[model samples]
Target: MLPWDAPLAGRLDRHPFTSELLRGNPLGDPHERPLWVYVPPGYDDSAERYPVIYVIQGYTGQVTMWANRTAFRPSFLETADAVFAAGAPACVVVYVDAWTAYGGSQFVDSPGTGRYHSYLCDEIVPWVDAHYRTIPERESRAISGKSSGGFGAMITPMLRPDLFGALATHAGDALYELCYLPEFGKAARALRTYDHDVFRWWDDFRSRPAFTKPGDESLLVAFGVAACFSARADGTPELPFDPVSGVVEPQVWERWLAWDPVRMAPGHAATLRDLRAVWIDAGTRDEWFLDLGATAFRDEVLQSGLPPDRLHFELFDAGHAAVDYRYPLALKWLAERLAR
Candidate 1:
């Protein structure tokens, strides 16, 4: 692997985007977000249009983290550049930022987080298409991500079949009963310090170094996801489970279940059928048990009538944290099948 800060054959362009949709959001996050686009090696030398891949991030992941270099591993940007330089299919890769003060936007539109879904589909997609040499069609466009971003990839194409037609999810969140319900009890115990009120936990969280408290991560996820999935109309995050008792609030929790890809696939059968490619993978030992979620998602998509030939599914040997190497693999897979 190349050393950190090595030069790339391709060029990465960073653009600042001010979103009208996110202005004055409940969390008071900045509306001006950083947008990064990676153009393949020969992009500037040729007039050819390219397929586009939208890269979404996991919870609490911001755009700059894509450049994060681990020991003996190059960043995804470098590895992806290698793919193009070696003459695999070329594409324009877009890294989107959907961060909120709590951690992430979950890439959904809610009264609590503002219209992030609209910002991505209606604004960012059009902006990128208008400014770049893109095929500008759903068949040539895809979205990929891990965790929360993975959930976004799984649903965006279904919600807007007119915009995206392909997706790759690396242990993307799903099978809420398995992936999420387990977290409820843990979060409830953590909520004890704050009187079983997530807002109180939130206020204390912002007052000091994050994650310093043992319960910070679990509680943050509880609040952040609730903010994304079940916030009240007035913009207050409503926990799907009672924070003190860990009792499932059936109605609120159902709203969260409604977003699970496994449950959603049956309703989006027509949309899944139109997808050119779908890649689903997870570590067999994923802490969240997303490997099970992946299997369930694959089975559900197949039952929804997506051609078996169009999907790629795998359960690898590792867990969820250091799965960056898998990104380029999926990119290559998608590049070959995307309209070229």
Candidate 2:
């Protein structure tokens, strides 16, 4: 295997996308963002419309990270190219950016984060279909991501079955009690130094290089997701748990639970049943215990009446980080299943 950049058999086109919904976002994040669309080999030579797989990112991830190369493995961009080059089914892959001042928008709409979910389903999907030779149907579209991206992948299809038909989630956040609750206590302890005020820690975090502090990850996820899931009417992030006692506030916590994919499955069973394919996986030892979440989500999907053959579930031997290698695996799987 080549240790460095490999030539792609496909073409990745980068475009500047301006979002009307994000123009005056609460965080004042930029309305213009990078959008990447990758066409598989032979795209130019043929007049065929291909299925599209929309790729989103985890927390703190933006569009360009798809090109980031690690030590031995190539980036997902390269590996995904290889999937089509080797003849798994051809697909047009889209990389979306939903970055926020708090690091991620969780791909949801909120007073705190703005109308990101609508920006994606309404703006980006239509923009891709209008610009590309895509099949332009839900069965022809799939979304994939890892971690927070995975969470988005799981929920997007559920929320908008008209736009997405299949999905692949790698350690996607779910089972709030298992994946998120533990962090509340750790964040509370970290808040002790900031007078139990996450905004104070946020101020400190911005004052220095990112993630330099002890509880940066936990606190960031706590605050950022609160901004996505439980923000108040005036756009203030309300912690689902008290910062000092680490006790979950019932009303706010229920708001967070409403966004949980595991909990969301029962209500969206019709959508889940309509799905053509679902790929779910996580490391057996995911640091956030998302493997448990993955398992619970799989159970929910199965119970929702999706056939066993249409679903792919696995538990790998690794952890949360460095799982980019798995992206192409799911990509190839979804490519074979998405309507041609």
Candidate that would win on lDDT: 2
- Extract clashing residue pairs from model 1: none
Worst 10 contiguous positions by lDDT, candidate 2: 1-10
Off by over 4 Å in 2: 1-3
- C-alpha lDDT score of every prediction, in listed order: 0.93, 0.95
**Model 2: lDDT of residue 72:** 81
Error of 2 at 226 (Å): 0.4
Candidate 2's residue-wise lDDT over 1-340, tens digit each? 5777778899999999999999999999999999999999999999999999999999999998998987888889998999999999999999999999999999999999999999999999999999999999999999999999999999999999999999999999999999899999999999999999999999999999999889999999999999999999999999999999999999999999999999999999999988999999999989999999999999999999999999999999999999998999999999999997
lDDT of 1 by residue, 84-200 (tens): 888889999999999888789889999988899999999999999999999999999999999999999999999999999899999999999999999999999998888888878
TM-score of each predicted structure versus truth: 0.98, 0.99
State model 1's lDDT. 0.93
